[model samples]
Target: MDDQDILMVSEAQIAESFDADGLMLKPLTLFIKTEHPDVIERELSVLGFFSISTSTTPEKTPMYEFTLSPLNT
Candidate 1:
């Protein structure tokens, strides 16, 4: 791994790695566009990470704070 190199991985790579087992990705905080936080939880679970906790936000806004686990190597 290169030092100080953090790649914003494409969704394709994330999915491929899910099946193919490529280099690992660090945990991420994705700000999903939605009023509902549950969707982020579900999506992250599908993406192979557990949701730690969500920050408080107004229901009308689409941005949700989701902390997920590191990607599986």
Candidate 2:
């Protein structure tokens, strides 16, 4: 994969909020430029993220949205 195909997540890119139940929620929005977005989705699932939605940018780049919460919550 070229450098442009690699997805990088910065600390500032991660957003945290609390649900109504006071559960901490981490939401992520990733615009995948790679041809195989499933690989990225699987990786995120391994990290405990739940797939929220999947879409595409105006340019047709795959876009994935995910959310993660504490296992206890």
Candidate 3:
């Protein structure tokens, strides 16, 4: 099949979330949980907030990009 005939589906880009001073998401989550378990619980209670607040479309299943390799004669 020609290159144009190949079909590919890819995942949406995930953004890096940070605190006001630029603390990374993981670190921030850990820090918050350590000091305030309630905060983490509250955050989790509001499901889908991360993607929703960031305007990201949730991925139900993993998607991949399809590549076409040329057949050798």
The TM-score leader among the candidates is 2
Task: List model 1 lDDT by residue over 4-67, tens digit each.
Answer: 3122335864564344554445544545555556655766577655435566446564556665
Q: Where does candidate 1 have its weakest 10-residue lDDT segment?
A: 1-10
Q: Give per-model TM-scores.
A: 0.42, 0.47, 0.21
Evaluated at residue 44, the lDDT of candidate 1 is 55
Off by over 4 Å in 1: 1-22, 49-52, 57-60, 71-73
What clash pairs does model 2 have?
Answer: none
Q: lDDT rank, highest first? A: 2, 1, 3
What is the TM-score (0 to 1) of candidate 2? 0.47
Model 2: lDDT equals: 0.53
Q: Please give the CA lDDT of all the candidate structures.
A: 0.51, 0.53, 0.28
Local accuracy of candidate 2 as per-residue lDDT tens digits, 8-59: 4554545445456655465555555666666766776686535444555566
Q: Any runs in candidate 2 off by more than 4 Å, and if so which?
A: 1-4, 8-26, 60-73
Give me the displacement of residue 16 in model 3, in angstroms: 26
Note the residue pairs that clash in candidate 3.
none
TM-score for candidate 1: 0.42
